[model samples]
Target: MSGKNVPFQDLFVTMTKVAKDAVPIGGLVLIPPKNEHQLLFVLGGTAKVQVDHKHSQPILAADTHFIIKPGQSLQITNQGSHLLDISIIACEVVQLSRADHKLSAASVKTFAYFQYETVSHTPRSLRAMVQKLQEPSTFIDMQKLLENQFLFQKLIYLLMDSHASQTDADPRHAVESTIEYLKLHYDEAITIEDLAGIAQLSRRWYTTLFKEITGENPSDYLIRLRIDKAKELLTMSKESLYAIARKVGFEDEHYFSRRFKQKVGVSPRFYLHNRRILGTTVTHPELMYLLGTIPIAAFSPDQEFPSYLLEAFKQVPKLNNSHHFDPEYFKPFKPDVILAAEWKDYENYDALSRIAPTFLLPSHNDWRDELTDVGEILDKKKQAHRFIRWYDDKRDEVREQLKLLTNNETVAYARMTQEGLIVFGNQSSRGKILYTELGLIPPEKSLLHIDGKILSVEQLAGLGADHIILQIGEQADSSREALLQQPGWRKLMTSPTSRIYTVGHREWYNFSFSPLSTGFAMQHMLQMFERGVVR
Candidate 1:
């Protein structure tokens, strides 16, 4: 009787029942083995179906249909966020002889069951049939029994057709089908060769086509998908890291951590701590450095850094030529939080916020206020306050020293660029350090704007300052040398009361209002004024 398929005409439906049940979140439904075969169709939500307490598959609404054989127990757990609605159809079948128009008692076997494969897309009529079967019938007449028999046979035929269509599908269609399967079963241990076989393609060709289509190899794509799910569970659930690792298809937690870091730029523990910070602007990195934590990555539009920070940030990866709010570029290095300055042109805030907790500091906020906000986000308010205090003390000390060395002498900061001479105003970071913090006065004709303003050499000379701190740009070295050959520059160089000091452009221009760069800029200024040279 085992594994025997009775002819359609010989099969008779003795009894049939339709049961509709709703399982709440975290609810469980167990159906013990009975003498009838059962068809389970998910009406809504998701359920983890376990057959015979061994085989398990996640069934989603309208996507899959399951059959439970007689003597096989079924277990369903609500795995989705909402209620799980499912319809179960149980029916008893026995062989009947049409010759005598009688049921064959000897052919009634308890272990006999239909060998139907699970179908992903059940027939549209199947649901309607199940609903009709649910209609009230106070008396079981011969006509009602014959109608049930006809419907049951139609369902068996639909299941058979679905299995045949899938098995006989074109190779290309099979590959597409396999890709859908991969998305649903990424947590399962799947191998490349197994996927290729499902796609009915050679492994090499399958991998090549997969990469060409998806921009990643099959294995890498699968791992990235798994990692994305792992990230969701890590942040949304209280599951342990080990449990998460196993749930996401990784057998070892250490291996999971290594892969996570490779993909996300931080270990799982660091991610859980919310320490994998990504700085979308130069200022955020400087502030994070002052907070005693290095960002996982920092945006460097020009691939440049201050001389003082070059060594400390030598190992940090630089994000070059990236849009201000490009979330796709930042997705691979899955940071715990993203720090960005509010930009007038920023339009993709939602995209970045989807990747991590994004903190957009006001663009008009002072560096101190920005640091306070960042500190709060990273849970390092104490460090932020301490650094602010230390900066204030240092500024006071530097101001007194400057006043003593050059009493009321006007000092100016300028940078030599390929375009022309650019001077900093009181609003700039370097300008704030010298004119605001250290009490040094800027030349009267210098640009007083928030950023560098280009000026002619004559306009710079017109300011008539006693001292000038000039930063030499990378492409302006020849310009600097050529400027030195000018008569006006030589006059200032040899002047008894006037002096000019040169520093690297990278060091000067990268300095922001953040404490780390601000403090470094202050030390550089003091070194120039005391030693008459930039060290």
Candidate 2:
């Protein structure tokens, strides 16, 4: 700004809201679109702010402010139950001249090419000045000061000074840099001590911080990342499984296949078969999809399908009557076997057996067992094995991708209900995929428990996980929302690595128990993990 005065003018504050009601849990509040630049500050309450798909962050700390550039839409959602208070200061850039050229008066246009930044912590001098000006005793003085050009000049200079003093210093900086290194050299043999050396921290301290931030240990993270890369090559390219395995950091292809089977429940070779033929109506549509077969008819309690099952069920007829399965509905789509899960009523099993060779599928923690049984029943045991292999390949791919994104961070899955939060175990559901299948580390506290246990807010908060996957049920209300506003929940939100991811309750609860649900769940979970944080 080469004018006779400073580059900015202190326009009056445009809007102020105090103790504004919070948006309900899983609800969003949109900031009215504006064509003018505005300085928005999060005066109180923590929220998640998303400006389009590329810009999103948690507003947990106070005084978190960001510039709303012209033509930008801001979406602020209350991640907590407490009311969110905010204020907007509308400002203008003064008309200036530099070297015979007229400077744009529009603040956005003026800084169009320059990178705009935020001042999280006000400088000491500026803070003191603002405090003094805001004092009740200085009411008249403040009014007079606002009317003077000197006030605008001082503010402009202070902002510039603050920007100049900003430094790239943050706690996560080391971890982020080390992850970048890992991504670039994922194909190489890397070790925990080596990564710790990259961070320039002692091995124990580095490992601790890595797990605290990423949810897994360094060795597991590295191995998973390599396997993920190998999976991409196996699926998207024409490379042989052996070559692919070696390319992704495995020394022996046989060893790679063993590890892949243990983690993914299938061999790489068996996973490549793309199609399967099913001659009959199957009760487990999700399982059919997992086994690489499209069912003639699918049974669900209702028409509302989980995201994982949505695409597969689009054209398939639903053998459902409202929220229950009717044995009569199976008569229309008569053909082969009906795979009835043990979780459902078996009285109709005999009736279903009459319609077709209905096999009562045993419900189990390990989804592979269900898959194997379904294969055996359908006389596609070979195809089922191939599906498992395919699933394992996909699992490896997802694990690798997550290893890069999550590093050593751990993830915890919990469900919010009327009673309390339910901490899912690592052996089933999203927990199994996120922790066991995906190779993500669980918080030490979570390791002590198994799945299907309800936890108090204190337990959920104290789980010590770096990231949380909060499963929201269909019947969830304000009471469930209030649970998030608890002191424990607030503490979890304040951590540097604290991130809460919301997923539909139905999608996660039973998706892991069956092969059908597991396939879709694995695909959906991988996509979520790769996307990193959810807003």
Candidate 3:
């Protein structure tokens, strides 16, 4: 019987079953039903009583009792051919306070002074209660059982006192407790002193014993644990390196990176390339986005991302160059593969490979072929070809869509900087989308040879294009607003059949080379042409 069927109020003995049975030779009663706490008393014959592995050899003698706690099993055997009379008490503590009336689960407190693994000798005072319990009774009154329950509570207190003393005296238990504490509080700022306090040992003594028990020094173990956790975060999320440093208990980002590189053998930026599975870390955000992969972190985001690339990379954290080349910073976001651009003098190449498989693609020129090379490395060759085809088709589609404008008006792409009005070439700053993709002709005087050629404001009017796409770069640093108020600017703005359309300066510059960026520029320019300039 269990506590479920036993009706209880205040403090009382919920369930009791008494029996006297005889077992023949070679008989076994292995692990019978037991309550939260049970008392097994040997009334007459000798029987082997075993609770667990450690409780063996402490035989049950006449007039002696053995206690069993929950989760522990009891095995009784009659080794000799003799009848064994045994008294078993199934006792459970129940809710006693009136305050517990509305509680969903009753509070059951245990008072025991011994570990379940060890055997305890019955005290002298408990003998009287054992004698009263041994009497043969098939039926018991509920009200009278409450009066006797007082003795059970008293028995629990005495056992608890004994257990506390034994547990405190054992040095092994203290070490185990300290290990458990470290596992739970590893993420918090913890010191050797705190661990020593948990173990109740002097700093030097605790350090020696911790190494003895765990085989590694306490500080080394803690660092390894933190790095392991950092590795997990690096693989799973797109959190910034700084945020990750703070999370794993490294307040100084640089020191965390140094420690990570020391243990992991690569700087955080390069280490990002390799993850557990097919995870990605790319230096080229624009190209990776076009290739259908969200990079865990990007190196050159150019201060901000374009509107089109924002949705894909909005959650992707930026990896700044300020921390130098420490690969340990990327340990938390354990990337499986790192995609990087070919460098002029790449120093972290070896370091990156140590962290994860790092692939360096061509940085400049022949970008279309470079896209395919990156695809082969990333195992997304099919998607790469499909994207190329889709981009070609979109270029043709936009070319046809802009037929009216292309036939009549030439487009001019220029940026207003602090130096002067800078014009762009077909190789950079959305020039390919305007001239090559959409088939928009450039004006004869539009500085087509120079990538970022600066010219006077008066010289801008010489460009024969019917429309001007002006990119305002670094608005805070530029005098474009004051220039626009000049008479020369007014004349340019009021030119017949010509319109001035403004766009983000740095954003347009960064979107020059990637397929995704080209697509965004194409669609935006087409919309502007079809709807006319708002201002």
Best by lDDT: 1
Candidate 3 local lDDT, residue 505: 49
Which of candidates 1 and 3 is the stronger one according to lDDT? Answer: 1
RMSD (CA, Å), candidate 1 to true, equals 17.6
Candidate 1 regions exceeding 4 Å error are 1-270, 299-307, 321-327, 445-452, 533-535
Backbone clash pairs in model 3 (N, Cα, C under 3 Å; residues 3+ apart or in different chains), count:
28
lDDT at residue 285 of model 2 (Cα atoms): 62
**Better by lDDT, candidate 3 or 2:** 3
Model 2 C-alpha lDDT per residue in residues 469-533, reported as the tens digit of each score: 78775466775779767887677666666677777655654656665555556666667767767
Clashing pairs in model 1? none
All candidates: TM-score: 0.49, 0.42, 0.45
Root-mean-square deviation of candidate 2: 26.1
- The clash numbers for all candidates, in the given order, read 0, 12, 28
User: What order do you get sorting by lDDT, best first?
Assistant: 1, 3, 2
Q: What is candidate 1's local distance difference test score?
A: 0.71
